[model samples]
Target: MSELFPDGDEARTLARLHERLARAADRDALLDVGYRLVDSPVGPLLLAATEAGLVRVAFDGEVREDEVLQELAEQVGARVLAAPRRLDRAAAELEEYFAGRRRRFDVALDLRLARGFRRAVVEHLADIGYGRTASYSEVASLAGSPRAVRAVGTACALNPLPVVLPCHRVVRADGSLGQYAGGPERKRALLDLEQH
Candidate 1:
């Protein structure tokens, strides 16, 4: 049996515990505030979120820092800070990975932005093994929704984990590299990194 807190407080504690458990069940469900900005081959990628966890990861070409952070504040219920260290380790790993000195990411990931089918798809993508590629259809099947090819695509589009989740590993069934939220050139570069 679980240890109980002081009488009346026990019920409240149970409720809080249940809420946290529910959030854990949903990968995209987080409740924290954090921020990260890292350099990428494409340029700087800025990320921000509430304590519930990371809520935004925007490309350099897409500049909407204030609006994005403000929105994250409203959604995650916390003020946003400009702490790049939240992703510093991720940035370092990415730098090494991109430089061909690393393989896997060893950084904390705030996956609260991905939920439901999208969360499932992202999780499955994360398991796609390095240097390997899978078709959209294959990933959809792995996500337990074999016919959700389009949905899988949407999930890839929304993936916050990017290189960690390896959305670039997802390709068209016809052997064509498909569109990437980060862009095709980056996708090509990432795939080449894995291939060679």
Candidate 2:
């Protein structure tokens, strides 16, 4: 009687319900889209995936959760569900990253949200490596357009996948953190976490 939940019935009920839902989701035949909200050192992240791969990763409060899901529903398919199993590998890898156990992600990525120059920019950004910082101009040059530095900045801003692609590793020519999809402080933390 001295506890907030004295009987512990609520906890048991929730665990049982989670099991049922996980089982049911596993049984669903046409589950083309799966999503889950996972916690990160920066904040909560909304991860969504399709049969193709990890489609979107959104930071908590960066955008409304429903808006992120609705965008996925429109971009991928309408069969999205809050299924954690599908995102288990992604969650594990992200956990490893935050723990500093992983320098690179092994999860498959779906870059359908980005195409053309942005896609090229994102791909190049991934190669910038762990603890390495590349300037916008350098990224643009590597992406095959030295004069498209501004476009490179745009690409990073709209990067569908942040930590996985290492977009936070890109910085201003003066070594400033510049803009980040997950905000500047999060970017700084990721960089600091990586450099150490």
Candidate 3:
């Protein structure tokens, strides 16, 4: 046995208990939201999903784990759990993306976190294409609000799904990197990754 669990039986019992709890939750439809932490080139990322699809992706430095969970509980549902299995597909797709093996994310997305024009802006970001960029004004125009340049920036800032949605592909009119939800450095890193 390991030091933490001197008796192997205790570890096994705990594992079984957790398994039972997960099964029971699923069976009873109590698992409203499931989440897991994934390591990436930038930093640790929190991935949350619901029955509909992948919901939120948060950066560790930008948001606290507990805060993310609390927000999900309030905005989504209170039956959130550390259910890694539920987010396996999202985690794998992210891994493939960071490794440059994948250019598009096929995972279903629950964009309830954003609404109205913000949702429209983020949804349009996916069309920016891999390794290509669009100016905020261009994105605003594409999103059908030609004059809402600042609104486009706000939409990117509040995008619930960052890398997957390719919000980092949006830049300034002069081709300068702008503010990002994951910070400027991370945005630069993502752009750099795509360039190569």
Candidate 4:
């Protein structure tokens, strides 16, 4: 028992310290962003949120954690922390979605990473509905740029919040699964999940 408990006091102290630090950071508004990693049918997803709302969702295989954190620090703010509590709601919503119990996400979003045309395209994705897909041409038309089919694809590719924004609901005009930031397999999985 001593071998494992040789530093029991130290472990408890460390836990207490971390709790205090998190609380202080929250109290002072020093936590510009809070993030967590959650498992899903597709893969592990890195969820990030600001005081405003969920900012980014990156697939583990698509982007490295360090890179995502760096991008968040640069584009959002530097005071990022691994505050799981802050993302509890987002994680639960994702779990519900993967379980086929949730069709729509109620999470608030921060779309600062997307701008101009891209923002318009992703914002319109919500209209795509659950378990249904729309072609790039159709999405482009819906976004008020009837000829910008390619641009619609690009917008889905660079969507900041993938699953939450329902970018997987966008497909190529030929009835094919197109590119996804989380990769084609993940897009297929998400689409398939929604179908059942």
Find the candidate with the highest lDDT and give its number.
3
Against the reference, the lDDT scores of all candidates come to: 0.74, 0.89, 0.93, 0.90
Ranking by TM-score: 4, 3, 2, 1
What residue runs in model 4 are displaced by over 4 Å at the alpha carbon?
1-16
Candidate 1 runs further than 4 Å off: 1-32, 49-56
lDDT by residue for model 3 over 1-196, one digit each (tens)? 3666567588889888887887688677788898989999999999999889999999998989999999999999999988888888999999999999999999999999989999999999999999999999999999999999999999999999999999999999999998999999999999999987
Q: Residue 2 in candidate 4 has what lDDT?
A: 61
Instruction: State the lDDT of candidate 4 residue by residue for 87-115, as single tens digits.
Output: 88999999998889999989889999999
Error of 1 at 174 (Å): 0.7
TM-score of each: 0.74, 0.87, 0.91, 0.91
lDDT against true structure, model 2: 0.89
| Distance from true location, Cα of 109 in model 2, Å | 1.1
Which lDDT value does model 2 have at 2? Answer: 68
lDDT of 1 by residue, 1-196 (tens): 3554347677898777865654453345343555667777767777664444344667766546676566667756554555554555656777887788887766556677789999989878877878888999999999999999999999998786677778999999998999898889888888988876
